[model samples]
Target chain A: MIGTFVVARRELSGLFMAPFTWIVLLVVLFINGLLFSSFLYQTQGNVTATLSESMTGPSFWLWMIFLPALLSMRLVAEESRSGTLEYLLTAPVSDAAVVLGKFLAATGFLALLWSSSLIYAVTLDYAGGPPDWPAVIGTWFGTILVSGLFVSIGMLASTSTSTPLLAAFLSMVSCLMWIAIPFLAANIMAYLVPLLTSTAAEQAVLAERMGSVVASMDALRHFSRSFQMGVLDTAEIVFFLTWISFFLFLTARSIEARRWRG
Target chain B: MIEVANLTRRYGALLAVDDLSFEIGRGEVVGFLGPNGAGKTTTIRILAGYLAATKAGRLVVAGHDVQRDSMGVRRSIGYLPESVPLYPELRVEEMMRFQGRLHRMDRQAMRVRIPEVLERVGVQDRGKQLVGTLSRGLKQRVGLAVALLPDPEVLILDEPTSGLDPIQRGEVRDLIHSLADDRTVLLSSHILAEVESVAPRVIILHEGQKVADGKPAELAASLGGGGHVAVEVMGAASAEDMSSLIGSLPGVESVATGERVGIHQSFEVRGEGDLREDIGALAMTQSWALRELSWQRPTLEQLFTRLVTGRGLDELAMPVASGPGAAPSSKPEAGPAGLSADAPVLASGLELSQGPTGPSALPLGTPGNAGSKIIYSLNPFDRGASRDLSKPVSVDAPPEAPAEGLPDGASEETES
Candidate 1:
């Protein structure tokens, strides 16, 4: 565990010290900050009424997933590409430590990217708008949970090959698919419900039941909608924790396999 | 400190390291020598406990089984890979701390040890400098520093002096010489002369198997290869008379008449042992004033030429007869194993016409010529206005394990 933290510290230092890391952070923050301020302007003096509405939009979710994927894509791939992975894996630390170290660093940056919206939240509160603290906290939770999954997925992609660009491309495709899964499943169910049922009433009931089941399987359902409205569900929390561990465990396995393959 | 048996690593059908076995005791600095594709790096990586040999190979490093307790083995070994890969974002001091932490050194110990290693490698001033901003030579020093941070029981360096300029190379050699006294070091390089200069015991790999493993001098002598001694005599005697006069000695194999510059008559003497004393005596008896007499140690090029003539491992130079279970080819081209029959090389030490045996103007002396030069300690720490490093108990050092208590014959295991 100590070795894992040490590796995390080294990797985190590497990430923050590089110009690219900082440049990417600045650009994403600037872009997100711009969008937040525009939402604030749109809220006008009735900021309390629409704070949750503004935070739950498409741009927030998209940037949360996109930025983390971009950042985490380099986590293992750059180390392998630069030949430092050889040094890293050869250290007395376990393969899991190396994997977790990189994951920790990428996730730290992703969290920073997601939480930068606190500036807008603080501004709204200072201007006499209700703090909407519950919504604010919930959105923060949902954004991080979403970014956490994307970052871990990106990390897994990073380990599959030594090419950073390819890793980034893979992680992007996977994260886009994460969003598209729910929509795809719901659409397929929508198209099939009418065909599978005879009466119109039966079709409506079957569609509702199938839609809820498929929607529950979609990892993002509760977090993006209900959680952003300040209603955190235990099942959504469990889902986030479970899948993050799953991806992180896969990342560790990928790293351990390098010894056998190389 | 290290032992291996029947180590084999195959990249697909190509055998990179084939059934190699050797032993290295503590306080010994051995050279892992070979041309490209001879699996020198692979062997070092395995020894360092980073890479695993294919199953059924037994490797013990620092008293721990490399396969079973790899982390323990890694903790005891300091490895410098062929190209020193460093984090560009890290400062020299940061990199040291990073390695120290990886080795599980205490933070307080790391604080003190980091400076000590940096000082030892002669880079104390540059600890704050980023690794990327430093030159290759300095980067190598930092790499050496990182390796030394743990004060590991065994050091494995892969081509440590490669790519450095001659002066830098010499400095690194001197540094390695200092470190060999108390700690064990195993360095791998394709250049035989580089190994000859630093390591006393050499394990040469030909086509990923041990072709020769012994002291460089022993291998050279057993192969009928040794250096030459040339004398410049200014006298009335003809070159033919001088040649015959020097050739009368038992050991002098052949004497060649050299340049006739004005009144000076030069003769190149080739033979075994130190013929300098014999030639000087002949010149004294004849009352001929000899201007200069120096010996040129037969370089590894001589060894390669003998191999080229099929005197050594002829199959080593043979091209891969065919793929998979076919005759392994030290290939003359497309990498080493496939084309060795034609080029007979890929050996790097041949470039220097004047190799390690040329002359040492510095107080640093070769293994056999200890008394001839002034006392100089290769140890940078012992530099209190120069001290003799010839003491029985020297500092933790260095390369070239003295040829003693070691197997006289290299383990020759055919490809299995």
Candidate 2:
């Protein structure tokens, strides 16, 4: 790990040096803050209820969808464009170390972004009757898991191309498709049962099975639910870590291929 | 120490480097000479471990295998690519420090090494300045300083003096020469003069293959005949008259006028041995008021052209007589005279016009003739003409020829 630290340090320092990172950070935080405040007003001082009812679900999803695009768009894309990738690859560092360092740096940045949303948590505590502290903490945890997953997907996309915009778009598309498959499958199952069945009983049986499958799929959507409830689930943590490691592995392979092609 | 054997790199269909092999001993400053697209950069990149060769080859750097132990090799070698990529926002000192950190150099070592390298490359004062803000020359110096960090055993620099002014180029050359005391330097450059002054041995790459490799003088003498002597006259004597007179002198095989004549007339005398004294005496006898008489050596440019273009000054000096007004008595010897045994004649086969034999026969197609004239050949092999002729050739006349009619024999007597 000394190699990992060196790569991570260079990447982190580069992020600070570039104006794009700060600009993205300010814009993201501004938008997130505005949304949070509007969410507060929509609740009309009932902060705890607002968060549990509507804010937690949508805000968690929003951060999941947007954070990855923001943090990972520059991971491999910027290095490739600036030609620093060559320097890093040629250094006395393994490709895995390079990829891990960059991934961790993006994850750290996402954590920082999540930390900025602590003000919303504070508002809920001060204004509302004793908030569901466990739920609030769970939501934060779920948001981290989801954001971490998205960051990995984004890094994979970034490694696929040298253009930041393309990487962001591809990452967003992949994330949307993964989440949207269950919804699409539900709709297809609903339409197909009416066409295939004659008797109401047969239709009922088919509908029940389809409902079960949809329920299982929906359970997958609750992958971050435990984190939202402030419960540390081994399975959920493993899922996020696994996702991060898988994409990082892919990014490392891409970099290794580049050394041969460089 | 570095060794590359059968190293070939292919980018899709384009072969960037093909079957290249060479070795650089420890502390040897070897200059890499090549024209544009000659694959010099590709070779250096492979050696630096920035690129992996497509076809497997044995590339060892400082006893570490580049393929198996690339990190070790990379740690031991420092590379400066053609375009020095620097973090624009980082100051020179910061960049150096960062590189040192990446190399895992201790803070104390960096504190001492950074300033020393900066001073050695003449960029000590610019350490606080942002790298992007520095001029190209200064940036090059900064790039050199960065590569000099960690005290790497090998330093690979590609086109180090590409955009520098004369003074800066000289400074860089001097710095490279001074560094030769401890480090092995492999530098690629298009500047022939700088390579000559700095590099003791040179490896020339042409179309991805190493065309020539040896000491600069050994390679030059091997490719072409011995050096020639160039005489610049400021008197009334025309280069045509001087060419004929010099051509007739013993030990002088051919006399060709260089680019600059009259106020800057240059006559190249090619032979097996030095003929400086003979030319000086001839100048004195003719009262030609010689402005400059110096031994002209074969430059890296000549060797490079001879390797890449397959032609040298000797081939370019061949007699060219086209339709009509061409004199029959002007044909000179067609074959090159003093070529080393191993030197390959670029355009060996096709024959040009032959001048009739006579005392008045002018060496037609000879590079620089009596008058301030340049002769062109239709053959693609005959090119790379130079006006600088500091090296002279002394010709030995046929033993039966009338000695009384020949000019001064002072220079010729010393030849053999």
Top candidate, metric lDDT: 1
Cα lDDT of model 1 by residue, B1-416, tens digit: 99988998877788888988889989999998777878898888777766768853679989999989988988888888877888988999999999988888999999899999999999999988999999989988899888888888888899999999999999999999998988999998877678888999988787778877788777776775566786887543435566788999879998766544333456677777779999998998876668889976545646654553446422222222222111111111111122223322111111111222222322354453344223544433222223222222211111122222122121001100
Stretches > 4 Å off in candidate 2:
A52-67, A126-129, A184-222, B231-245, B256-267, B283-294, B315-416
Q: lDDT tens digits, residues A1-262, model 2?
A: 8877877776678778888779878987787777766766887756666555443556556556766876688888866887767666766777888888887777777777676655577765666545667776666666666667778788888988899889888988877765676788778877899899999999999989887776544424556457656688887777667766787788778777776666
- Give the C-alpha miss distance for residue B7 in model 1, angstroms: 1.0
Off by over 4 Å in 1: A43-50, A185-217, B225-297, B304-416
lDDT of 2: 0.71
Candidate 1: TM-score, chain B only: 0.64
DockQ of 1: 0.58
